[model samples]
Structure formats: C-alpha cells, structure tokens
Target: MEKTYTRFEHYSGDRTYQNEQLVEQALANSDFDQAATQGKGFCRLLDKAYIFQDEKLSEYSIVIYTLDEPGLLDSAAKREYVLSEHDEMIIHRMAVVRNGQYLDKADDVQIRILDHEEQGGRGFLTNRKKLSLIIKDLHLQDILIFENTLVSHAPQAGLKRDFKHVYQEFPDPFWFYDRYVLRTVNQTSQVMTYKSCFFRDAQHQVIDPIAIDLPIGESYVFEADNFTTDYDPKLEVRPFIDFATKASYSKVSDAAYQIYEKVISQNSTWLETSAPDLLVELAQHETLDEKIRFVIEFVQNSIYYVYDAEIMDGHEPQEPQITYESKQGDCKAKTVLLKSLLDYLDIASTCVLVNYEADYFIPFYCPSPSNFNHVILKIAYQGRHYFVDATSRNQFGFLQYRSVPEFMYYLPIEPQADLQFREPFWHQNYLVEETVTCMVTEGVGQIDHTLLLRRQNADAIRQMFKNESETYLFNCYTTSLYYNMCLTDNFSEKELSEYFTDSKIAIVSDNQDLNELQIQHDVTLLKPYTVRIGKKEYLNYWDRTYLDDKARDFNSRDLPFWLSHAREKLTFELRTDRKINDKEKVTLQECKIDSDFLCYQTTKAVDKHGARMTIDYSVKTNAAIKGEELANYLSSDKKIRDNNFGMTIDLFEQGFFDKLKKSFVKK
Candidate 1:
C-alpha cells in the first residue's frame, strides 16, 4: 500500500485516464518489479489475452513554419501514432526538430509489444515497442508535431518523451540552435555551432533527406542515419548545409536594401555636431592612451553583451544606430558601436565580423553572417591591424590577446559592409607577467599570485575575462599536491568529502572529516618542520599527468627536472630553518629557475621548517612573443577566470612543484 505521484498525465477517449502511484508498501512485498512496472509502463496492457498487429494509417498531413531563414523549410514530411484502449483509443505522438525545420513525415508509424502481461491486480505488462519516423528539411524554427493525435478525440495528443530520450527528440540547443554567427576575415565564410547538446532528429531515422541548393554562392550537404528503434543512438550525419547566395552578394536582396536604407546608409543628424564634438573631445584627452582607454572602458563595462543573431528573425546585417539605440546588441551590435566610436575619434578602424570562438589567430574568411558570432574593431596602428571586441570588460590588449585557437575573427574591408574578415597574425605582440608565492604550515598553506599583463588590444582582453571569471576560480591551487582542496565557509564532513580529494586536506573549515584526515595523513616530520603527510603517492600521479604528458608538447622536461631539483633544496631549507627556528626572518633573491624565459627570476625563503616558505617570481617574455605564446597565455588566463572552483593551478614546476611535495608530506 505505497503511495506514488505522477508528474504528468495521459488520457484516452472515455472517462479513463492514466495515473501513477509510488509503491512504498510494494517494496516490502514479494513483487517489486511488478509494482514498479505497473506505475511506469509505456505500452498498453491488453486484457483477455488479445494481440494486435502494427499497420500504417490511411493518410498523413504536415505543416511547417520558417521562423529564421527562407530555404530552411523546403524538404519536409510528417508522421503520427495511434494506440487502442479498452474504453477508448489513445495516440502517442512525437516529432523531430532538425536544421531549423520540422521532420513531420514518419516511415513506419506502428507499435508492437515486447513483454506479455497476466490479468491480475496490476499485473506485469512486459511488452515494449517503438514508433518510427522520418522527415526532411530542418532549420532553426523547425518543430514537428503529431497533427493527427493533437486533433484526435482524446483529450491529450501532446507528445511526451523522458529526459533520457531528449537528445533524439531534439538537437542540442547549446551546440546548434543556441550558437551565434562565427565568420572569417573577409566575411566570405562563417561557422555555426551551439554551446551544449539538445534534442534533434537522429540521422538514421531521417527518411528522404533533401538538400536545398540556394542561389547563394555556397554548397550544402544533408544526411541522416540509424532509422530503426535504437533510442539515444549516437548516429550522426550532416544534413542541410548551404553556402551564401552569390546572386544576393552581387545584387543585394530587398531585405538588405531595406535594411541599408532604414539604418546604415542614412546620414545621422548627430554626425553633424554631437558626433564631431565627441570626437574632438576624445582627441583632447592629452594622450592616445587616455583616449583609447576611455573608448575601451566605455565599450567593455557599459554594453550588456548578448548574442541576438538568432532572435532577430529576418534581420540581416545590423546597423550601428539600431545597436546604439537599443543599448544592446549581440556580437554584431557591439562591434558596430566600437567602429562608430573609433570613426568619431578619426581613428583608422575597420568593422570586422569573425568567429571569435574558433581559430583565435586566423581571421575567418567567409561571406556568410552565420560564421561570425562576434564583431570586432580593427585599427591599423603602426602598420599592424589590432582586433578589439567591445563586449568584454576584463580583456586588456589588442586582438591577439583575446584570440583563441578555434575562434575565427571576421572583419569588414569596405566602409559600407557590416563586417568582413582579417588575418590571425595581424596584431601578434603582447606580454604577460605572473608571480606566485606561498607559505606552508604542517597541513596548511597560503598562496599569493599576481598577473601583470600588457597588450594593445583592449577589447579582446575585456571579453576574455568575462568568460574567464568562472574558469579562474578553479584554475589555481592552494597547493599543487593538494590541488583539489576546496575553501568554503562551512566545515560539514559531507561537504568536505564532496570537495576535498585525498591529495589535499582542507582544514580551513571546521566541518572536515578530521577523523579520517588525521589518520590518513598522520605521518609527521619531527619538530619545527613537523609537517604531516597525506598522499605522497599523488606526487607521482601529479608528475605523470602534468610533467610527463604536458611537457612533451613543449619539448621540455623542466617540470619534472625542477620538481626533482626543488625537492633536494627543500630538505636543506627545512633543515636550516628548523635549526634557526626564527619566525620573523624573511629571505629574498633574483635568479632564473627555468630555461623557457630567461628574464624570469625566482625569489624564495624558508622559515621555521614546515611553518612557511615564500616565493616571489618575476619574468619578462621576449619582446617578439607571438602566435602560440600570445594565444596560450590569453586563453589560459581566461580559462582561469571562467572556472569558479575556488583555486588556481598550473603545471609549471616553479608555479607549484615545491608546494605539491610539501602538501603530501604534511598530509
């Protein structure tokens, strides 16, 4: 006699409706699966031992709506399912949304039972069947529906599927639908992708997949696979990819013409007086740095960054006025505003639309707006093109500072177009300085690290930090050996177990599993340096994950080499400090600890053995640092800020090698 609750309801024609109850008491009984199955069954439970055959319906109908693009709705079909009930009949319906279109056409709209059921008190119905469907033409606004079921005599025809089946039902919104435009340098090509997974029609299930070759100067490929009843299948195939309209590029469309006249081509009254006055005022700011800083700060902190390309409906290239008027724009709007501001200042700037999410160094070369998710301002300063995105606040420096390997940046060549493309190496010179220091106690440590980064692409830096904020929290370490140690306000043992790994013991909070922690890492060094040790084995594990694999790419064995060298020195430092037993004394120095950057100097000191060790590092990368160096530093820094896990960590030996071994030793 257990009570159960149903989140949703299904109904048939008669006054009968399907309900669910939790079998709390049934668990104590002999039959558990039977009770659970009765409450959560998908197929019908036929009484009197009757069997039914699957068959196709007489007719099929479908309706489609194109909400995003025109050719997005061409190839389309529909499907529906019907189920017979004792009192009345019920139809279970489902639809697939793909390529911004709906696949309504179904191939085999039939159902079969797998398990047999005995007519008893909520007897077991061991039958499992699947409904199959196929459709063509998919796009953004695409949605499929069981038209017949919705219009049926039953009260409910709305199709429903469980969370486990969500992927098959719809394409990942984050990975596909949620993505904005990502374009190249010339604005000639672009790429579209989403942030996460979503429900979409599986490829194998798609029947009669068709491609719409647009008059645009582009090619397309459409595909699908695995049509049978394999739920949650990893079946993947390309479907409905098209290039830009060459005809439209040669002769603008009515939409483009209307947009240009309505926004871009029109001369603004503000340009006559207010705009010129603002420009003059900006110039009078005393120095180029001041004016540039003002522009950078204005764009970064003020505008609320949001990608609205998908939501603009039929809107093509956005106008600067509209973006300025709206006070908000996606990547396009923000780019336009920055360009306009630069124009007002009489700065030589170009408006470029590129995919900032891919190929950070290379400019995207495409005419399609679909590939450009970000709009940037390109200014030629001293014979170099500097990329700047106004949608960021934490970003500091030129375009190279914000460039990611996968992001493609697009730039507008002419003064009239929204944005075009550019090259990746346009603005390649930049520098970053980081210093990390820590003081270690028996099982505790304190770290202080600072970043002094310099660059010309201010816009790029702003955006980098916006996404980097979350990543930054988890990128560093309280201790490299105890890299996973979490800092929280509470000391609950449950929270401690959830956040604390065996590598790091966090006692900053009181709720830790002190019993387990004390016992596991109880091995202590005699006195003065009487630090407890936790998992020394993890030191080898750390070296394996970082020093071995990661160092190979750089062709450098410095991490392991430094770790080994540092370990030897630590004994002397510990021994010397233990004998002296002085807490107030501090040591300092300037010396190179590695070969990567010779300018970097390491200053460190050990006081009272396990009580503390401090390090202050400084380095100046070569003036010509570009390409990988620029991209790596920017991306890594942004990643650090974006992760919110509460600690920063790096594989560099100098960054954490000493602290890691000590963390394990003191555990």
Candidate 2:
C-alpha cells in the first residue's frame, strides 16, 4: 500500500499546497484497522508538528481515520482547537481536508467560535478562543486532516519580551496511533537541542538535521511506532510522562528569574499603597507569624479566585492594587498580593513557581514559564522557612499547607536560586483522637462519640461540615457505625437522635491551643452493640479488625504504593447494666507492630461491668512501599488484622426458679 501525503502551508494570509496525492492506502498499512478490530474504533493516521523559528511561528497538523463504527463517527467528525489570541501569537491559517479533496471555501466547513472561559476560575482576558469545526461528508475509510499554523512574536511588553520559549507536547501513541512524527524547525540564531523522554517500550527513532557551523538554522525529527502499555492498576502511585519537546534559552532559571525580577520591580510602586483594608487590619497582629497567617488566610479566603488571563499577563501577575480592587485573582494574582503585604511588614518573602500536579517532572525540564501551573509565596520567619499556598482555602497553620508532595520540587523565582527539593515535616501529621463510649440497656445502646482533631485533620473535618448538609453528615456517621458494628436497621432517625445526636462541630483557631477542632456525635440505637442469636445475646466491642481488610489485597501487589504519614488514636469504652462476674474478665494482650512503613498497636481490657479498648495506628513513612519492605509491611498488617480484639459477653436469662424467688421476694 502506498502512503498518502497531503501538505498545506499558510503565511501572511497566503495559502499554498504541495504533493496532493490521492493514493488509497490500505488500513493494514497502519495500526488503525487493528485497533478498530480490537474495539478501539478509531485511530490517528498522522499527528505531526513543525516549529518554525524560536517561539515565533509553529504549525500543527492532525489526520484521524475513523472506522465504520456507529459511536466513533461523531467523535471523529467534530474537532475543537483552543488558541490564545495574543499580540505575540497569531493563527494565520486553519484548513480542513476531507478524503482526498481540500475544503478551499469558507462555507465548505462549519466553523463556530466560542469563548473558552473555564469555570471555577477567572477566564483568561487574552484571546483564549475555542474554534470548533465540523467536516462535511465525513465517512468511514475516509481520512480527515486539519492543520493550523500559529505565528508567535515576542511580547511587546513584560518580562517575556526579551526571551522566547517554545513548548510542544506531542500526543502519546496510547490514543491508538500507528505512527507519529515530532518535527522541530529551529530558525533562530541560538543552537536548538532536543530531548526524547518517551515511554521505555515506545518504538521510536530520531533523525537530526545536518549540523551547520553557522547559525543558519536546523531541524530535528522524532518518529515513533506502536503504543506501549504505560499504566498499571496495581501501582498506587506513578510518575507522569514528559512526552513533550521544549525549545527555549539554555538556562531556564535565568529566563524565569528575569521575568520575576521585571514583574516585581514594575509593580513595586503599586505594592506600597495597595494593601487591602482587611489586610491592614490584620497587620495589627503582635507576632510576625500571626501577621503572615492572617495575610495568607486573607488572600486565600477573602479573594475569589478567577483566572483573568487577559488583564494579568499570562504567567506574570497583575499589580497588587488591581488584585485588591478586584478581590478576585488566580494563583498568580493571589501570590503577588500576599507577597506585597509581606513586603510591607518587612518580612522576607519570595514568589515561587511550581507544578502542583506534575512537580515530580519539573526538575528534569528546562526552566520555562510554561513548566509551572501554580504559584506560591515562601516566607522566612524567625530562623525558619514557610512555604505558603494562598490559593489553599482550608490551610490554616504555617506548616499544614506544605505537607503535599508537590511542594517538594518548588522553584523559587529568584536570580541565583538553585532547584531545591523539600521534605515534608513528619512531625506535622494531622492528629486524630476519637473517644467513643457506649452504654447498653435492654437490648438498646447509646453512643457518645467525641473527636479531637488538629492541623490538617481539623481543616478537613471543618471543610466537610461547612460544605455538607446536616442530613448528609448524619448519614455518614450512621453508615460508619452500621459497617463497623454490623448493626441492624431497627434504629430510626428519632431513636438514633436520642442516643447518637447531631454532631456538635466546633473549630478553635487559637494559635497556642492543642486541639484546633472538635466534633461530637451522641446517638441511641436498638441492638447496636449486642447481636441476638436465638435466645442468646452476644456483646461485641468496637474492634479495629476492619482496618485490616484494606491491607489484605496488597499482599499480592508487587508494585509500591503511597503510605501517608499519620497519627491516629481511637478509644472505645463500653458499659452495660447486665449482671456479670469478676472472673469473666476477658483481656487480649496488647499487640504492637513497629516498622519503617507503619506503626500500629491495640490494647483491650474487659471487666465485670464494662470494657475498654484503645487503638493507636500511625503510618511512619511518607514514601511508597515496595520489594521486601512492602512484603514485610503486608505481613505485619495481616498479623495486626488477624489478631481478634473482639470479646463476647453472655447475658444470663431469667429461669423458672428466678420467677418463684421473685414471687417470694416481693412479699
């Protein structure tokens, strides 16, 4: 089968074409038919790119060939293209090819333009437009090709005016492509370099253009065939793929620092006068830490986050005055405003750029503005450094927000700042202390539960209560008890409310206090603690056995998984009015398993009238578990789960003799 070739170019409103071949290429020549046979339904015939000049002009073209499947035609027929209409970039040409004929007239294709303002954040003020095109007469075995050439110029103003960075991400073959090509045309004065970071099993070959001694320009081509399975369900955590080519100035840090320096200096005058009244009021805090916290909270909670990309120069932040007046800004605007307030307080702070979702791969990429998705402010206070993300609404304390893994690879946008990786402070784990008491009488039990949470745990619970309705929260509590205690469905909302009352949630923000949040739930239910079998009643105490079920499935998994650092303590006290003897005391010897990955212990004690059990479970490691360590952890977890902490109490039933004795005692 001969390869069908179609090429088109448009520059300065002039359209040109070459090699318009109409060869009927066999479906078997590519992997499209095989993927269709396997129910994939459609495949990309060509996903190609061409970067002309530095970041100035680039052309991207895609050709998708759909199978004769019902559901797949709709997806393959319509196409959407997103582009930012900035003075620096222009979409010079957009054309579509159906089968072997090119759509030369405007009416040949159905084109619709829509504002691409994303929800949950402010829309970019720039020319961020979505172009939707519908191809006419699309059919199976017919090829559909769409191409657009974008010419990018240097920003007329701002930090990016001097430097140019170009980034192109090629679609992975996992989308069921038989062949893919990544071509880069570097027509700049600087020498261009290409790095291939494709998946291990991806069959690929790179062809570099002949090197010239002079800066005449060069082109690099990368081609790949077939798709390699890149995901594993067994693995709990995986590193994202860097399947893109970045062309920019050699020094990434230098380029970023230049932008940071320029933006900050330009807005320094406005920063001096643009402090919000709320921020000014918060500035009265006696301690620097308190002031910083107040500023962080103000920027995070007070300002509504909206990404106004037009007013705010892309990655560059708008003036602090504008952010204060708007009371709404994205991460960049919030970070800038927070930094400005900190500067007014004479605190040492720096704006840092980070990729919250893909921080693991940021260190490997060349430093460019496009590398980062989120921005945060770093403050140095009293012989320590605090990385504060003002965009986080629920983060209260200084160290609480830094617990996430993305902070590990954050880059400070400063002129000599080295790439530094941060380690999560293990001591800052959220603490959860739950005390539950159960009192039983006449086959019914009342539960009084109080939870004391600190730091992240407190923030999480508070957020839940604030967002969820009262009924939803009650249902959650009921669900937990139902699953843990194997409770019957005999308890009604009115009966449950008498014993297990509505949760009384209180949050304390005192900086010096030990407990930051408290939630209490008291409930009464029928046969909550006791299960009846025929005429015999058995009392089952709250057991930590349910925690073990999660680890059982991991015994067979060979891949490593993320284990969060945690410190949790649960205590249960059960008291019943049923008569008992001292000799019937049941005690399970305390079991403790301590390792690098996890630390767990449970202690149980039973007496004549009541029983007490306490479980202290903590995850000791912040890294993934694998190899022998994973096996050891799984074995220990199994041991912890296998040790039965449940004890049964037999209630004495009144006999005929007791009835006669009661008749004699009544006189």
Candidate 3:
C-alpha cells in the first residue's frame, strides 16, 4: 500500500485559496501517497503563504518557502527564493555539506528551529563544508549532535517561520497575526525538529495552536527578542452606555419613562395626583438625612440578595417594569430600581459597572470588564457625589465600611467627565473606644465592656475585617474563647443561642473546676479599622496582600500607618477601689481600703520571715494624668487603640466569703 503527502500554503492578505487540485496532484505522488497512508503527511495553511510539514517525522527534513502570487511556488520563473537548501544545509549562516549520504536510525535525535522576529541579519558560525555523519548503536546520535553543536555554538542566529492568530474583541470583532512553525520527525523514533522564524521584538506575540500533538520526549526552543513600544495614554478610558441613568431616561429606552407615559395617557386621576416623579422629587426632600434614610430603608427591607442562582439563570438586564414586577433583583437589579426612583425625582444618578473586589476607582491601565464583576450607583446631590451600594446591611447616610477607600469608587460620569483614577488615599485615621468592667466572686467573674467607634479614615479597617473573615477567620479565636472557655454564656441555654451559632466548635470541656464567668464588651469604630480579634498573634498569617500581587511588593515603608512605641498616644488603666462603710459604730472597726493595679504573688522575707503571701496594688488612673505619660509606667509591649485607658475593680469586702471558697476553715 502506498501512502500520500499533502501540502498546504499560507499567505497574507484578505483572500481565499482553492487548493483541491493541487492537493490531489500532490497526493498522487508515490512518496506523498506512502507518507499519507502512514498517517504522517498532513499540512495546514497559515497567513504568510508557505508550504509547511504538519505530520510527525523522525528521519525527514522540512523545507518551507514563501510562495508567489496566487499562493504557488514557481522554481523556474525567476529563481528568487527567501530560503532554499539543496545538497547542503545552513545553520546560523554556517553552511555544512555532507560528503556522503548520512543514514542511521533516528532515535535520540532531536532538532528544534524556533520561529522568531529578527529583522536585521545575524550570524555566528562559519560554513563547515563536507561534514560526515558518524553513526553507531542503531541510533542517529552523532549526525544530530554535529548539527546541533554548529547552531548552539553560534552567537548571532535567526530562524524562519511564522504562525497566524485571531484576536477577538467579542460580539463581531476580530484581527489576525501570522506566527507559527513546521515540525518534522521519523515514524519509529520519538525525536522531532521545528523550523521557524527569528523575531527581534521583545514583546513576543504568537499564534494560537488549534491542538498540540507533540508526543513524549520531544522538545522545542523559542527565541524571542525584546520589542518595546510606548503606550498612548489616550487609550486609557472609553465610553460605554449604561442605560440606567438619569440622562438615559426616555420614553423610548427607559422602562420607567414608558410606564410613566402609559399611566398618564390613561387619564388616571389617582396616579396623576399620587404618582410622584421618581428622581429629583426624592432629592428635593426637606432634609438630606431624610432622603438618605428613606433610600436605605427602601432598599434594605424591599430587596433580597440572591447571587449564584440569579447569575446562573441567565437573567437579562431587567427593564424598569420587570424590576418592579419582581420587586427585587440582584445587585444590578437593585441598582436599576434605585436609579429609577432617583430619576423620577430628577436626581442625578449614574449606574457604574464595577469589579467590587478589584476597586475600579483605583487607576488600572488594563481596563477590562472581567475585572469588574459587580455594579454600584453614584448619586450627586448638593454639589457632592455619594456612592451607594445596596448590597450590604446597616449602612446609613454617607457611612461606608472601613474597607472602602476613596479610590475604590468610579463615578462613571459622562465619558468626557474628567475623572483621573488615583491610588488609595493614605494618612487616614480610625478611632475606637472600649470600656470594660469585670467583677469576680470566688471562682466566677462577670465583665461588661462598652465600645464606641468613629469613622475618621479611609474604610481600610472594614474591608480588612471582611477579607479576614471570608478567608482567614481573623476574629474566630476571640469569639470562640468567649463562647466556650470563658463561660460568659451557657452553651445549653436557649436565651443566647444566636450568639455562637455561626462559629464552629473546636473543643468542649466539662471540667467542674470551671466557675461561672460573664464577660461583655462593646467596641465602636468612628472610622473603619481592620478588626483585630484580641491581640496581634498571627499578624501576617493568611492575609492575602493583593497590593503586592497587583502592583509592587510590600515593605515596611509601604505601611505608612505603622505605629511606633515612642509615638504612641494611648492610655490603659486597671483599678480596684475598696471602701468599707460602717453603720453600727465601734462594733466593727470602720475602714476604707482601696488599691489600684493590683497583683498577687508569693514572696520570701529576707531578714527573718521565710515565706509570706504578698499583695501589691497601685492606683494610677487619675483622669488628669496624660495617657502617654501613664503608658510609660505600664507594660511597654501592650497597647490600646486610640487614647482610651482601661480600669478594672476587684474588691473583697468580707473575708468569710473568701475563706468559704478557700480550704482554710476558722477554728
């Protein structure tokens, strides 16, 4: 049985080639037919118009030459050729001619001629003419080694090959590039050879392979040079119509306008008198606070967030009528409804496409819709723009979580509206206040803490907590300890069942030595601060620093908000004030005993007494003393957020109660 060989030609320009006859003729050749029957000789055309070898071949050479017009190579017409090899070969401009036929098994013989961009002439090795193929051990190793050494030793070399690629911009858009190579190999051996071009451009762009068919033990080398280009800043921003906006509101395109016109045309007096403009009418409320509060309540109570299912159901962008039909949608739907309400009221609003996680307000030269996975609304009122995200709960007025920053928002004002993105704003501060009081009786302790927070900085803290909770469980340890170990609340009780429902249990203890302990803490943040659970035990563990991955690496200097001990302006106080009041005069001696910052320990007397129980207590929180000055005398390692000082009181009014709990019994 005879196999067949098929040859295809690739050419640049916008035209098609009918090569059926040429392919049929080529298939008739005995060698071509032999190769084809063996499932070896198959070829595909590329953009640059050249004959390439596609099938695997271990003991064969691939000869590809650019064709003339009409995609055909005429060797007799003008004797003009880009690259041609006939009785000899050239590697890096170094010609090598075999004196005799070089024949041997093709095992362990690998050759790779990578296609690259090299405009100027480049070469390293001179011609090594009349070479010999030293073959041995049923392997074509010597001849292949001789061939590779000549090219590897060369300094300046270039290859000849190019592949074609299709660049698509989605929904009826495509561009093309020519870049690829021809491969050859023997049928019995796994070794292979690649012939391609040499490119000088460092920014190497290549053709996409339809399917890779390389077998085991085959290798390829690609030589890509540095090609650089200056970016035209004008390409940074583009205008994409987000129809859900005040400007886009019209009877033709917007659903709200259509509904409004239809309702009014019916001559319904009730709708005319009761129906209010949804946009500017709301903004005209007597107070900004009222408008904000209304909007928050309307969105939070009215809409339910459904994520995965909504996106997966292939829901199209809802028209105003459709949104009103469901009375709820996802983020996009919520945004559109809000926009319509504001639009009816004549409020200026714009719907922005965003990748909530990516932070669109931050300058990203690579503008991509993929980066923006979510959407938000920006409303302008009283010469100020407010960012409204209805996806969250408990948000009011202009209050944003600490995780949001000035740069994470994109107003998406008209395309012509000069909006230059900037990096995250630094130097923002957060203030948090917490007050805790603990009362311990016998082995049981009861504590109460009140915390107040103020928004004073970029919302980094809120975002930090979100990030930690989602991935690393930053506050898990503190919450768990309180619910489990501290016995602040009983696990079997029904009153506080909701407190620890979200947390997973790690350990359970039923030790009878444990006393009933109650602890309550209230913490408030005026500004978003990364929520710290209890202390900075695992500072960097599980914290994914995207700033490092997206832009530059992180360093200490990059942490501009870092706190230092010397610069700390903080106060933390603990005190126990004891005073005994006497009612029956002289029956029992009246005394008032109080101590601040008390500590208990066993001590040895130096003079005569060997051992004694010692109690050391001191009072330092005078309310008048400067927090910074007081911190100097306390533990240097401990710190409190803001200048808030802590105070604790543990007084023993009667020794009998204490003695009852202890082993000592009065005789």
Highest-lDDT candidate = 2
320-367: candidate 2 lDDT, tens digit per residue = 777888888778778888887777778888888777666654554544
**Models ranked on lDDT:** 2, 1, 3
Q: Mind sharing the TM-score for model 2?
A: 0.78
Q: How far is 482's C-alpha from truth in model 1 (Å)? A: 4.6
The candidate with the higher TM-score, 2 or 3, is 2
Tally clashes: model 1: 144
Candidate 2 structure lDDT: 0.58
True lDDT of residue 258, candidate 3 = 31
Candidate 1's TM-score reads: 0.39
Q: Candidate 2: how large is its RMSD? A: 6.7
In model 3, which runs have C-alpha deviations exceeding 4 angstroms? Answer: 1-288, 304-317, 344-347, 360-371, 381-384, 393-411, 422-432, 439-444, 453-573, 576-667
The C-alpha RMSD of each candidate to the native structure, in angstroms, is 19.9, 6.7, 23.2
